[model samples]
Target: MSVLKGKKILLGISGGIAAYKTASLVRLFIKSGAEVKVVMTPASKDFITPLTLSTLSKNPVFSDFYQEEDENPIWNNHVDLALWADLFIIAPATANTLSKMANGNCDNLLLAVYLSAKCPVYFAPAMDLDMYKHPTTIANFHKLQLFGNQMIPAEKGELASGLSGEGRMAEPETILDFLEKDWQDKLPLKGKKILITAGPTYEAIDPVRFIGNHSSGKMGYAIANKAFEWGAQVILISGPTHLQVNYPEIEVHRVTTASEMLESCKDNFESVDIIIAAAAVADYKPKVVSEQKIKKSDLEIDIVLEKTTDILAYMGAHKKKQFLVGFALETENEFQNALQKIEKKNLDLIVLNSLNDTGSGFGTSTNKVTLITKSFEKEERPLQSKEAVAEDILNKIIQNYEV
Candidate 1:
């Protein structure tokens, strides 16, 4: 799969003959599985219509700061756009725009976004050879570079001026290649393998009834996606949940019962470098399961319960070089219970989620968590999206465990 998959790419188009090339560039980015957002200079709309780029990108192209068509016009916040992007690319950057960017001139919304962006910025300059070689253009290029902007050097090709020499924007395919190579080199978990268990395991009591928790598998799936983005080969052993793994790097094994989940984890445990037991495996299961559903006529019913397999403890005991992580969901004594689990399971780290916190716990998109280590270190994180929480957990693991 392409490294650009799931990336947020902000494509900035300026007034130039090569502005038309941005259509192909947006298509390439989308084809590579990236979310592309186009921001065009007002003059760029004259060369290529915003409708064309917007349709291809599947996002409304932004040029003006506000929507004047509405009774109460909404302001398009440039800072938010700047912070939202994974990378910003300015294709067909004209000398006028380049000069404005280098001099910190924020005349247009595009320029304002450029000035505020915290992510990496790349510019592809396009103009006639004479204009491209001008002293002012050269100075602006150097200034932008000194400010940490990467220049995708204009290619030598046939120009609109009927002169052919180093003034055309790089081809869309070439630009894509450059981005993929650069991102690949920066992936921290490129060669690592991660095994994650997620969702609630259902312990079957009968054909029609089972024991299960309210776990929606959001937390675990979020972790799996984040790990895949970091270039790890992820083995997501998930319980019965509606969640789906979209990344090619993630191999998912779906299971329903606690026994099935345990077997799945054991099968993949030895091959993985990191193991995260995030699944809410049932502790007890009915000892005697009826082949047929229990009749409702009984005045009272009795079902014997027995302990289920401890997957985390089993993996922890058998661990060699793998970093074992566990999760503790508690309603009381959260920290103590989590710490006890870490010691009993021999986990390298444990994530604690308490039901006391609003907007946390199962079936929610947000989470409030406390990360505890075997060494008694604790870090508390406020309520955040599950995806952000997943990234935090992975960051801790990478910092302390990854060699």
Candidate 2:
């Protein structure tokens, strides 16, 4: 998946023949999973219509400072548009617009938004060969870069003036590739591999009956999503969850039993830098799973049970350089139980969840957790959405991550 996934990108269009290309650019950004809004210079409308852009972007196109509604002027807030963007890109940045940007000339709404923007700004220059190589235009490029704006260097190609040289704007595909590479390079966990286990495993007692917990896999899927967003290559081992992840970057392995989950973890454990075992694996399974359904004939039918494979302990015993983490859902002595699991399971960190805490535990969207290290140091978090809890857990892991 593109690193631009979930990013809010504002595309600025200026008057140039290349303004026609912004339509393709917007489509490409949307395809890469980015939210796009377009702001066009008044003169740019001659090259591309606002209706065309609006239809493609599925957002109202903005050109004038204000539009008449009921014959009343409703201001288009430039600051809000600037602040809403995670990134701003000006493609077909004509000489006129580039000069205005370099010299603080806010004549149009696009220029006003650019000047007000707090996010990273990128400009793709488009002009005739001679105009692009002019001393003033080159100076503007240097000035913009000095102001921390990135330049998606204009490609060498045929220009509208019939001259073949470095003046044409980069192609839509090239711009997308450039953005993804630039963003990925700066991510903290760009090259790291993370293995996370989520949901509750099911142990079969009969063909039609099984034992399972109330785990909805929300917490684990949240972590997996966040990890991928932070640039980690994620492998998620889920145990019979109905939840699905939005990011395709996360590799999912589905399992039904604790034994199956363990084998899946074992397959990827050696190659990963970190492992978070959040699954509530059943401690016991029926020793003999009946092939046929057992009818309700007896008052109580007794089935022999045996201990399931301890996945966390197995990882603890076999870990080499991996930073292993475990979760402990406790009813009493929460802190002590969590600390004990840290040492007994050879975990570097453990997350403690209590059934007593309202809005926490399984089958809920919110969670309250105490992050405990092997040294017994604890950091307690108040009840919050599972997404926020996931961020906290990943942050703690990142703080202590080495190698």
List the candidates' TM-scores in order.
0.87, 0.88
The residue ranges of model 1 lying beyond 4 angstroms of the native Cα positions read 1-6, 58-60, 64-77, 130-143, 291-301
Q: Give the TM-score of candidate 1.
A: 0.87
CA lDDT, every model vs. true structure: 0.92, 0.92
True-vs-predicted CA distance for residue 343, candidate 1, Å: 1.8
Candidate 2 segments whose C-alpha is farther than 4 A from its true place = 68-70, 103-105, 247-249, 287-292, 302-305, 373-384
Cα-based RMSD of candidate 2: 2.8
Clashes by residue pair, model 2: none
Q: Considering summed lDDT, which 10 consecutive residues are worst modelled in model 2?
A: 67-76
Error of 2 at 152 (Å): 0.5
Could you say which candidate leads in TM-score?
2
Candidate 2: tens digits of C-alpha lDDT, residues 101-191: 9999999999999999999899999999899999999999999999999999999988898889999999999889988888989787788
Q: In model 1, which residue pairs have backbone atoms overlapping below 3 Å?
A: none
Q: For residues 88-200, what per-residue lDDT tens digits would candidate 1 score against the true structure?
A: 99998999999999998999999999999999999999999999999999999999999999899889989999999988889988889988988887898888999999999
